[model samples]
Target: MVFPERFSNLPEYAFPRLRKLLDVHQAGGDPINMSIGEPRHPFPEFIGRAISEALEGFGRYPPNEGGEDLRAAIVAWIARRYGVHLNADQHILALNGTREGLFNAALALGVEEKARQKPAVLMPNPFYQVYAVASLAINAEPIYVPATAETGDLPDYVALPAALLDRVTIAYLCSPANPQGAVATEAYWRDLIALAERHDFRIFADECYSEIYRNTPPVGALQVAHDMGADPDRVVVFHSLSKRSNLPGLRSGFAASGSGNIAAMKQLKNYTGAPLPLPLQAAAALAWRDEAHVEENRAIYRRKYQMADEIFGNVAGYQPLEAGFFLWLPVENDEAAALKLWREAGVRCLPGSYLSRAVAGQAIGQDRLRVALVAEEQELQRGLLRLHGCLYQ
Candidate 1:
């Protein structure tokens, strides 16, 4: 048997790499996991009732483009959250999760070649791993644009040369970005949309963490594009119930774009996608329809954010998270910091370098630790305190 060589250069996924680095050392105390972004908050109590009511639907084949009710619920949620109205049937495609949409959208919409050459996909250097793999899957060049402190913690794709810009097909952006927790501002979205219009590329807006913010709600790319009168298909935004509803196990999400783009993604999905089972879809629909639970969930995360700020306030380079649960704390060496925290304080975190790629022999993430604030309040506090003592002190 032969394995694909394209992915051979990719590092092992973040969590497994964390395990390999720390499993040999016995934790000094009771283990406190602050590594993965899986939410520890309780899901809505009504999810079970919704699932049970729809149990009979499982006997039939699931809808390839999500059930009507689920799509309507998502449509309504978007209107309420982003002030952008979209036709449920034309603009939305429910996903197994946003990861599916994020990866597959490239395949569905990315041009086979541009300017008589292999197209390029641009993503933030420390981006979600799916974007890079998706670019490689299509044999497009994956240009990793760094999202460092200097770039307002966002990738400045417009800064690239005109030669590369002309060849670009897709640009993946994460608002309330993973690892760093930096939210892209409205102006940032407008500038990027203009650049994409000028260069002719699609923007994959990963807004999974849009609801987990501490202050103002982050702006959505679709909303900005609509306001700017950019091409309706210019930005494809992916959202999820995983973070917003604390339902990672359900793996329910949706993509919103122009009717044509939605159709393209739907056509691709029909051949190679697992639609959410009817029961789970029912639960997800209810989750999307209800915002009380989301507000409650957001409140819990807000408390956690305050806790993290209070704990790490004095630590050098601790920028309070703008959104999402992860704290991308700067360190002299990420792997060393993570290992020291695990071995000495029983606090586990993912090394920042694991989430990023090296560029020009310089690893941008080599000096930071991405600590997830997803545990219960007490556990999260203890883990942060211990991490502070072990790494900062």
Candidate 2:
């Protein structure tokens, strides 16, 4: 049997790699895992009831484009959150999760070739692994631009050479970015959008962390594009109830864009995608329709943000997270630091270098750690204090 070679160069997924690096050593004390970004907060109370109420829908095949009720709820959420109104039927496609939409969208809309050559897909270094996989799946060149401190922890796509930019057909961006937790400002979004317009590429904005912030809600890509009156098809924004509503298990999310893009995505989904089960879609609709639970979840994360800052405040080079639930702490050597923390302190964290790839013989996160703040309040505090004493003190 033969397998595809496109992913042969890709590193192992983060969690598995973490295990391989640390599981060989015995934890020095009680284990505290701060590795993965899975939320520890409570999900909405209504989810179970909502799912039970719609149980009968599972008896029949569900719509691949998402049922009308679910899409309408998503549209309403978008309106309330971003002040942008969209037609549910025309502009929304309820997804199994943002990862599904983000990956499959490439297959649906990625150009077969551009500028008379293989098209290119641009993504920030340390980006969601799906972006690179999707890019390779379509036989497009996956350009990994560094999203390091010098660039404000966001990829500066506009700085690339025009000749290279001309080959771009898709650009993947994540705000309140994972692992690093850097939020992009409106100006950043505006500049990126303008660049996309010039280069004739679409922006796949991953705003799954949009609902969990400390202070001001981060500006959104769809909002910026709408404000600038850019072509609606230029930006397809993917959101999920995973981080937003603490419903990752529900696997509910949606992608919103212009009707033409939705049509193309919907067409592809018709053949290859599994629709979010209708019972779960009902629960997801309820999740999106109500904001009280989201507010409560946000409040919990806000407190955690303060806790992280207070604990790591004086540590040299500690960058306070702007949003999202992970702390990207600088260290001497990422893998070594992670191993030492586990072997000596019983604290497990992801190595930042594992989240990124080497470009031009250099990787951005070679000397950092990605610590997830997704534990119970007391447990999170305990882990942070132990990590501080073991790694910094």
Candidate 3:
């Protein structure tokens, strides 16, 4: 049996490739992982209690669309955070995680063809892996725009040729961009939204790391769209408990958009989506409603940001993160730097090329590496010290 050709060129996922590259050499000192973005902070105290109280719901099939309480909680959070009021039942669908929503939104929403040709899907050169696969799965051209230093780490669809923009049916973007930690400001969103309006494409805004930032909270795409009064169908905003609430295990998130888009997603989900279990959904609702836990979580990240600045302050080109936990540290050779860090410094970090695609024969992240600051204070500090001494000196 022959498989589809669309995924033939896809590379191995980041982590497995990293293990192959580093497992041969023994770590030079005590092992510390600054690779994955998993949060090491103490998860909210109430997550456990909430799960225990809702255990009985597991005996029944979970709601495909979120239950009233869970949806209401999510809607309330949006209002409190973005000032956009939405009808909970009509405009939202709870997701197992935003990854599922991000990928499936492409399936449910992207057109197979536009202007009588295979449509295009736009994404940052180095982005969440799902975006590329989502575009390919739908048989669309995956346009990898440069979100590099020159572009301020956000893809500029506004600069794309009008002919190409007209073929775009979907564009995926991440704010507080992973690894880079760059955020799309309100003005940036307005320009992007205006571009979408002109070209008639949809923007899938991945705002998973919106809560953890240094100064101002990153603006939400949905908020900007609401303010501009863009067509309701233009933006599908996805958010998650994984980063915001430090609850990746909860597998809980939601997508909000026009009721029409929600209905299409729900229709697709009804047949194919794996509904988040009822008990976890109940617990997640509590997480969304409570801002105290989120505030504490953000405070922890802020402290880490200060710690990073103190450590890397003297290192030229070390960008103070605007938001999110990862540091897109510059290195002469990312793979070589990663190997040296593992062999000499006992620190494991991801090579930048693993996270990005090549454009015009030049890989976007070949000269950099990603260092996650998700570990506890002392451990993360030690790891950062090792990284700097091994590579920067």
Candidate 4:
């Protein structure tokens, strides 16, 4: 049996490789899992009631794009939050999760045969694995742009050569970026939007982590695109209830883009996408409409961030995160640091290199490790202390 060679060269998903590295070690103390990004906050109290009330709808297959009420709620939320107006019917599509939308958007919008060259999908070096897979799945060349300290932890797509930009079909950007916790500034978004407009490629903004931040909310890609008067189709934003409402189990999110792109995505989804369960959709509608629970969730993450600062602020090579829950700490070697933390401190983390690819003579993430701050206050404090003691002391 022959298999596609494209997938054959892909590295093992980060978690399994982490398991192989630390599973053999005897933990030194009570285990504190700082590896995965699953939130430990309480979801809204009404979610259970909402799900119970909508349970009957589960018997019916959900609409592929999303129900009217759910889509409208998402639209209203976007308008209120990002100041970007979207027509629910024309520009919004509900997703099982942002991952689904992020991956499928590549298939739905990625144009491989435009003039001659194989289309390129540009992504940050240490990026969400889905972006690379999506690009490869569409038979496009995946370009890993470095988003390390040298680049302010955001990929500099604007700086790429004009020739490469011309062949670019889509650029995947994560603000409050995964692992690094770097939020893109308004100026960053403006430059990127202009570049996308000039090059005629779509910007896939993975804003799933937008809600969990410190100080001001991070500027959104769609909002910047609108402000710049770029073609509406040039930017697509994916958001989720996973981080905002602390409802990862709900598997609820939405994609907002130009009418044409949303229509194309909806068409593809009709044949291949799995809609959020009807009951979950009903719960998600309420989740999107309510911001009180979201505020509380953000407050918890803010407190955790403070705790991290208290613990690691003075440590050498520690860069405090501006937003998001992960800490990208510079270490001698990511894998070595991770193994030491697991065995000596009983705290598990992901090695940064696992999340990035080598590019242009540099492994951008080679000397860092990503620590998730998704545990409850007490556990997170203990984990942070353990990490500091293990690594710094």
Q: Write the per-residue lDDT of candidate 2 for residues 35-116, one digit (tens) a residue.
A: 9899989998899999899899889898998999899999999999999999998999989999999999999999899989
User: In lDDT terms, how accurate is model 2?
Assistant: 0.93
Please give each candidate's TM-score.
0.99, 0.99, 0.99, 0.98
Q: Candidate 3's residue-wise lDDT over 1-393, tens digit each?
A: 777899999989999999999998999999999999998788889888988988999899988998899999999999999999999988999999999999999999989889998899999978899999999999999999989899998888899999999999998999979869999989999999999999999999999999999989899999999999999989999999998889998899999999999999999999999998878988899999999988999998899899889888888888998899999998889999999999999999999999888878978898889999899899998999888898878
lDDT of each: 0.92, 0.93, 0.92, 0.91
In model 4, residue pairs whose N, Cα or C atoms come closer than 3 Å (at least 3 residues apart or on different chains), thus clashing, are none
Model 1 scores a TM of 0.99
Which 10 successive residues of model 1 have the least lDDT summed? 1-10
**What overall lDDT, based on C-alpha atoms, would model 1 receive against the true structure?**
0.92
Which lDDT tens digits does candidate 4 get at residues 225-339?
8888888899999999999998999999999999999999999999999998889999999999999998998889888888988899898878877888999998998899999
Error of 2 at 161 (Å): 0.3
lDDT for each residue of candidate 1 in 80-149, tens digit (9 for 90 to 100):
9889999999999999999999999998999889989889999997989999999999989899999998
Candidate structures ordered by lDDT, highest first = 2, 3, 1, 4
Model 3 alpha-carbon miss at residue 121, Å: 0.4
